[model samples]
Target: MEIIKINDFNNHTLSESDIIKRILSGEKELYEILLRRNNQKLYRVIRSYISNTAEIEDIMQNTYLKSYEKLYQFKHHSSYSTWLIRIGINEALARLKTKSKVLHLNTAQNLNSNSILERPDTSQLNPESKIIRKEAKQLLEKTIDSLDTKYKTVYILKEVEEMSIKDIANCLNISTANTKVRLHRAKHMLKEKLFEITTNVDIFEFGFSKCDDLTEKIMSIILKN
Candidate 1:
């Protein structure tokens, strides 16, 4: 097997479809390209459902394997990223159904939620901005955790993933009206929980180290199998 560097191609130029085509055409190494590109988004989607680090890693690994196996069935009805996200979300939900215990979110500790606040310099405003951002992220995660699973899933898909209402409905196997209602309720709950906060900051980021590690592991498995 020949190793290919996806970065050799203009990273800004090749779309997901282009890479998928190449992978299907026998450039299997490019699958690592796809994994590296979408790792963070998929991790965030899965992280929204469960909090166990080991479980999250397992689900992500399975997600890649399942997606590759079903690649032939994927029609171009949705963007490739959306299709991948649906696969990841569904896999996480399936694992949740099989387990009886509820998992906790990473909470403030693992999030390093106080790092920004710990360092305060009057001359530097960036630290203040970072602190605000960190606090907002913590608040957002707390608010999301407070929501019921249905609302939380819908909220994350719509708000965090920026997925369309119809797409979310389809992905979750629910009606559009139901999706809308759930979204509305979710927003209301978030508003009630986050009345004091005003800025948007993304939470549940997959760290760079973990992203690279997972990508390497997935690539190794793909090559081995």
Candidate 2:
């Protein structure tokens, strides 16, 4: 089998559709490109639902394997990343149920909103800004974790991930209008003026080292089968 670097295509990365075709035709190793491309996405999506880092990693691994097994079943009705998110959410929800964390759109409401703070950003920052960003990130992470899974999931996908409202709706199997409503609710719940500032600071990041580690692990298991 010829190994093709996705970026070798005249400096243009291959589309996920093109890569998926190759993988379906026996170039299985190319799936690594897909994994590396979307690891950050899958991580944040699952992280929004569950807080245990180990369990988050576990569900992510399972989500990748599950998606691979069902890859042929994917009809491209939606973007592959969107499909994977739905699968990851299902896997996360199953774990939540197993852990008895009642899965409901309106659940986890007893907590007060006054204590909540705001969001993230991804650009390089100076030392002073970095310190302030880190502190803000910790506070925002804490605040986000306090919201109900339903609210935080949309919030992260929207504010942090910057996924389109339609994409978020598709991922969550809800209406686009409902997606907007949830985001509004999440922001209101946080009640912080720093929403845009924090996104530039990298909230819910799955860094490069972790991304590579996950890629290798998922590749090893899939290639073996």
Query: What are the TM-scores, per candidate, against the unseen true structure?
Result: 0.68, 0.71
Global CA lDDT computed for model 1 = 0.72
Candidate 2: tens digits of C-alpha lDDT, residues 1-225: 445875653332678888888989988888888788788778888877766667878999999999999999988778999999999999998987877765454444343322223334567877656666665566677778777789999998888788999999999999999999999998998875356445656744644344556789999999999
Error of 1 at 30 (Å): 1.3
Q: Which ten residues in a row have the lowest lDDT in candidate 1?
A: 111-120
Candidate 2 segments exceeding 4 Å error: 6-12, 101-127, 192-225
Displacement of the residue 50 alpha carbon in candidate 1, Å: 0.4
Clashing pairs in 2: 119-198, 120-198, 120-199, 120-200, 121-198, 121-199, 121-200, 121-201, 121-202, 122-200
Candidate 1, 33-90: lDDT as tens digits: 7787777667767777776667778999999999898877878787776788788888
Q: Which residue pairs clash in candidate 1?
A: none
